[model samples]
Each structure stands twice: as structure tokens, then as C-alpha cells.
Target: MKILSLPSSIGLASKIAKNIGCGVADYKLTRFPDNEIYTKIDTPLDGEDVVVIGNTNTDSDIMSYLFLLDAAKEQNPKRLIALMPYFGYARQHRVYNRG
Candidate 1:
């Protein structure tokens, strides 16, 4: 098992990895000129379980998490998991009725 740590959730990722006794995966994240998110997985995740950790505190954070997941999936990991410690959504937990 491996954990892919996003910039905003590095600390949490480390804690989780330590607790789970799993290794942290190597990856790179950058931004484009237009402020787009870019993710690169340096370690191959073939046949490995992957955990992506991040926070959705802003638009970029959400995009970063999505892009990271996509990159991890491309490596063909056995399973993909998401750990969101901080989601900035105001009411995502509540179901809304038709307006």
C-alpha cells in the first residue's frame, strides 16, 4: 500500500501512512500558466493499493485531488482510495430538495 500526498494534506498523509505502516508514494505536482493542476506519479503503482489524501479548501485543491487520482489510476493500482480531511463545501453532507 502507498499514500499519495497532496500539498495541502501532506501532514495528514504522513500521519496516516505512519499509522497504517505503509509507504508514501513519490509524485510531483505543479501548476500551468493558466493555473491548472498537473500531477506526475514517479513510482509505479502496479498491483499496489493507492490512497490519495488532500483537502478541498479551494477550487485548485479540488482539481489537484482529481488530477492526482487520475494519475494514480493511470498506473493501474489494484485499488484507489481518497482521504479528504478538510472539505470546504458548506453543505455537501445535506440532501437538497428541488427548488
Candidate 2:
């Protein structure tokens, strides 16, 4: 029963995963010389349960979530759980102030 914990930032999510005795996998990401971003996951994820941890404090984090979701799907994991400590813009629940 192995868990693949992937995080966007090491400061928040990784710290929690570490405390819980879970192994962290690095999803290699960097900005190129031309200011273009690149990312790659070099972990063995065959038939493993993958949990993606990320924050939605910024728009880029949402994009990163999409990327991680797609990667998890491609890896064909047994199960995928998305843990978002900070979820994005769900603050627009009001409709025309119809209270």
C-alpha cells in the first residue's frame, strides 16, 4: 500500500505529507531561459494510489492542479484523491442579490 504524494509547493503540502509518513514524489518543474515553464514527473506510479496536494491561492495553482490531474489519469493509478487545502473562487454563490 504505497501512496504517491505530489505537491506544488514544498512549504505547505510537503510538510504535512512528511509528518504522516508518506513518501513525496517530485514533479519536476522549472522556468526555461525564454521564460517558458516545464514540468515532468519521474516517479514510478504503476498501480499506485496517488494523492495530489496543492493550494489554490493563485491562478497558476489551478493550472497546476489540472496538470497533476491529467498526469495522474495518464499514470493509470488505482485511485486519485485531490487534496486542496486552499480551494479557488467559489465565492460567487449569490445571484442578483435575491435574498
Candidate 3:
């Protein structure tokens, strides 16, 4: 099993990795001048279990998480798990003024 820690969840992911005795996968994330996200997984994940840790605090963070998820899916890991510590939109669960 491997943990892919996003910038926002590094500390938590590191703690989890320590307790689980697993290593963190190497990855890079960057933004293009056009405000697009690019993600690259440096570690090989063929037939490996992977856990992605991220917190959705802002629009950029959400986009990064989505990009990460898509990239991880392309790698064809044996299993993929998403750990979202903080979901910023959880409070919008209800639509009170629906007609």
C-alpha cells in the first residue's frame, strides 16, 4: 500500500503512513499559466494499492484533488482510496427555497 499526500494533507498523511508502515508515493502537481492543473505520479503504481489524501478548502484545492484522482485512476492501481479531511461544501447539503 502507498499513500499519495497532497500539499494540504501532508501532515495527516505522514502520520497515517507511519502508523500503517507504508511509504509515500512521489508525485508532482503544478499549475499552468492558463490556470489549469497538471499532475504526475513519479512512483510506479501498477497493481499497487493507493490512498490519496487531500482537503478541499478552496476551488483550486478541489480542482487539484480531482486531477489527482483522475491521474491515479489512469495508473490502474489495484485499489484506490480517497481521504478527504475537510470538505468545504458539506454545509450546502440542503436547498431550503426549492419551489
Candidate 3 per-residue C-alpha lDDT over 1-99 given as tens digits, one digit per residue, 9 for 90 to 100: 989978999999999999999999999998899979999999888898999999999988989999998898899999999999998788877897886
lDDT of 3: 0.91
Q: Model 2: per-residue lDDT, tens digit, 1-99?
A: 233333445566557666776667656766689855556667766687777777776676677677767776687878887877777776767586877
* lDDT, residue 33, candidate 2: 100
**Candidate 1, residues 1-99: lDDT per residue as tens digits?**
999988788888888889989988999898889877788999989999999998999887888889999999999999999888887785776879765
Q: In model 1, which runs have C-alpha deviations exceeding 4 angstroms?
A: 90-99
User: Which parts of model 2 have CA positions greater than 4 angstroms off?
Assistant: 1-9, 31-37, 95-99
Q: What is the C-alpha lDDT of each candidate?
A: 0.89, 0.66, 0.91
Q: Order the candidate numbers by lDDT, best to worst.
A: 3, 1, 2
TM-score to native of every candidate shown: 0.86, 0.72, 0.92
Clashes of each: 0, 0, 0
Best by lDDT: 3
Q: Show pairs that collide, candidate 1.
A: none
